[model samples]
Target: MPSRRAVLAGISTGALTSLTGCVSTKRTGATPGTDSNTDWPMFGADRMRSGYAPSAAAPRSSPTERFTASLEGTPIGQPIIADGTVLQSTWYGIEAFDAVSGELLWRFRDEEPGDTAVQYQPPAVHDGVAYVGTESGLVALDVESGDEQWRIETASRVSAPPVAGYDWHHLYIGTIEGELLEVSLEDRASSSPGTVRWKRSVYGEIVRLVAPNIAGVTAGTTGGEVYMVYDGRGLWRTKVPGGVTAMTAEQGNSLYVATFGGGVLKLRTAAHAGRVSWHTEVGPVAQGLLVRAAGAVYGADGGGLTKLGTDGGRERWTFAEAASTIPAAAGDTLYIGGTDSILAYKLSGGTGVAGARIDPQRWQYTHDGGYASGVSIADGAVFAAVGDEPRLLAVE
Candidate 1:
């Protein structure tokens, strides 16, 4: 047995409504301590909604060099890496820079329009297309050309980043008011019913990319409802039980739900017609969720951390505020940004991943006054957004 030591490693809202739009993207790198270019896709990469990024970046014990910082506003949205370019959405707009050099690449900007309030989710980009979710509306732009691709809007605001499915045929986004609008990517790019894939309602507003379906795109509602439309032909709705803020992981087999109120549920998508298989209560006030390679489900809350078995319902382990930030897993290692330090854990069952001196030189980063946003792991580096500065830290 392990003593919570042994292996060492590292690292919502609606404003009232506008506050929820500025989501923080936290994930672990896949390949141990190397921040690779590929791997992380969508909020949690997998359908189960686990908030883990499997990159090959080395776990940076400390940041190589801190950057120019985002004075625009705090970076609540996660940073995305595509084709060697890193794109992050701040309260201001979408800013792209070189992943390795930190060179300013390009920026798509916007103003709050009025005291209306602002919420922005990290943009999703691929090939050369970048899709952004802003306080006012959504915009489609060419990643390389920097030319406008298409545009869509809603009376309300958009803070959750856009998730793409249907091979760019359709774009799904959630709003600060809880509206799930479907837009088209056709030559015209209109969200008309013909082009509209589908839409749903969440008694609460949609926060981030913790989407409903596994294709890792079509999002569910904030009211704990999973919206599904078979092949975009018919509509089906199912309610989980609580409001969702973060997506855990999107595995190939099941859909995992991490609720803001509490608990992490594993639902198996039917071989033919999928429905809820079973659900087990893990804990309360679960603000975060994660799944290990061992298939063990984990989550974080105000009290501490808790673990659940993959079998649907079972309690595993819980770590205190000392280990609160959403946990990220890649291979057998787990990384966490805790109240005291950036901790690492080994999932071999012995003790668990913890007990390392990240920034042992000085415990400058604290989770009380501010949150340690989610982690983005690659090769051997960790990217984190912290404080009011909207700073993206690189630890390797």
Candidate 2:
């Protein structure tokens, strides 16, 4: 596999600047979550939430445990990788570690040492900055030193990760009270701290947000409404059966959504008022998001992991005993977190055999507490945060 730097070198600077608003010339202070090709900057790896890492290859055999670092609190969401560092979000604060050695590098607390300021969403790292959402509001920290760059307090708790626009000049964050705020990242250097570009009201509490492309932002709400806003205008709103748990985009034209009750819906972004191409009842979806890769849509629910055909929503395979967290892909292997182990499965033509058991030949890592957080692959290693225990482990 090619290195991240090598993969990034092939991306035209003009294309990079046009897509993200910042030229990929400077690697030192580039936006925290902007290097999707190499780093798992945010959930689903990129703005489209594909959850697929192209440069990193999945481990063919069982990996050897490298190291595990204890955390201050339980990890609430997935950990992101950037510049050889792993960033994790916990109930207490944000923790960073050396990706290769699992050494504690820096810790950023949103509140005082003793006071508890719960942070449920993972931080989005880009351009040397780590943007995290806490109970108070959105806080930006310098990734290198863990210093506070700026913070914006919101009216309610922020449980969802902040999505960076293509230009990295703006950040769109959703609050627990159903409000979406657009923050200006460019004005942080001035005395103003940061500016609120605009604020919009959605139907319910926004649980997930993603910028599929430069055209607009797709937001999923707890009220079962998915809103697409572009250029500060609400383009369309599509209502699903249950509260939206996760969402992803395909080629900027299709939106894949996973609901809490037990369903996955695919909507056309450019259709007349957003048309539902297909909807399939998977099972009771717990907390994992939907991922699109290898020409199929993969989702995890209370029933386990299910692979659905993207063309017609046909059920291809179902793993009813896997982890409830979202699975990550590298090459043809699918890594999933279970209640007590990290297991790998083979994906043949984007589908697994129904009622098929996990092959012992593949990689498997068992721990005291089950793996709950999403797996991040980089530098030929798999990084995961162990649930219940305050630990993050790297296997290679």
Candidate 3:
């Protein structure tokens, strides 16, 4: 097989066409639940929700489609990689597929004989299990068998993506009613698998939650509140200019926030106090997304995408295209899911073009339907789920 660079070089001269048939490969006995160091196992790529895949070997030039598979339902969020399987949560259920050949592995649904469970957030995989937030509460399913291991019901609906840490056997989840609940997954091997460790009310709808490798949790609320909590106690709370739509943390100390009111703010939270380190109005919108990678922070919304320096929040570059979801980064290329396609941009600018509105457009993959979720990179494949016409495409 040709190297990824060689493959790109072979097709760099022109736009690639949409793949006609799905690709299939023989199974290699790789278990979907087995954790791999390079896997994009959750949203934002880690417990910190930084959306950076440092170890992944991504494309250096234009990429071509590796496979495409139709999904059972519309995907709710970005698809994640678990071991060698691609997992996507949809309105009807969750579907798992072979990442290499786009083969169907298994399906897990909350529907029972007479009742159906509704979920709105993506799942986080840890220790051979997938944890998801549903309207009722938290649900844990075995990654290999798609079996329900256990569940814990909460007072409100969990509407935000979950974060799982390897350091502890606990899963952190956010609800629509401003509750941050930590559920212990230590008893996952038993018949009764989960227990709510603690819950804290941030007094507003919890929009996002990050469980850093450190000893605390950081939450962003839709009511413009950012809270730092440790051991179920509020350590510090501060207000931002607008409702927090997205947040990314750098090593658990520097928290970068994107707001609906149109700005990005960096907060210093190392000493259990929330202090604004720097703030800038660089085009972040009401439904913004942030990714901390390549020594810079990328913020995107419906309007466009902006790149800012991490040291002092300096504006680096701006792409005047609507970004519908969080961007992903690997190596020197940044991938953004746009209104009608997945666009790639170079992190470094050309000489004599410092802070130029121009970004070297690296590659573009256009789909008939718009993107339903953000782009995810794993195992040399870029996975994107499409909207209206539900399907998942793997580009290499």
Who is ahead in TM-score, 1 or 2? 2
Tens-digit lDDT track of model 3 for 1-396: 764234444542232332213222112221222112367888888888878776677665677888888887787777888877888878767888888899888887766635554655778887788887777788888887778888888888887888875475677888889989877777565323487778898878898888764577889988999998888999899899888888888775788888886488889886848799998876466253477776678867765667787888887666665375767876666787877788877655321122332225777777766764777878876788876678888887
* Residue lDDT tens for model 1, 226-258: 554444332445567677644543446466666
Clashes of each: 70, 11, 1
- Candidate 1 vs candidate 2, lDDT winner: 2
Runs of candidate 2 with Cα error greater than 4 angstroms are 1-37, 187-193, 283-286, 349-361
* Clashes in predicted model 2: 11
Identify the runs in model 3 with alpha carbons over 4 angstroms from their true place.
1-37, 111-119, 166-168, 187-193, 286-288, 349-359
lDDT value for candidate 1? 0.54
The segments of candidate 1 whose C-alpha lies over 4 angstroms from its true place after superposition are 1-35, 39-41, 46-49, 53-55, 60-70, 112-117, 144-147, 166-169, 186-204, 208-218, 231-235, 248-253, 271-275, 284-292, 321-327, 348-370
How much is 103 displaced in model 2, in angstroms?
1.1
TM-score per prediction, in order, is 0.73, 0.84, 0.84
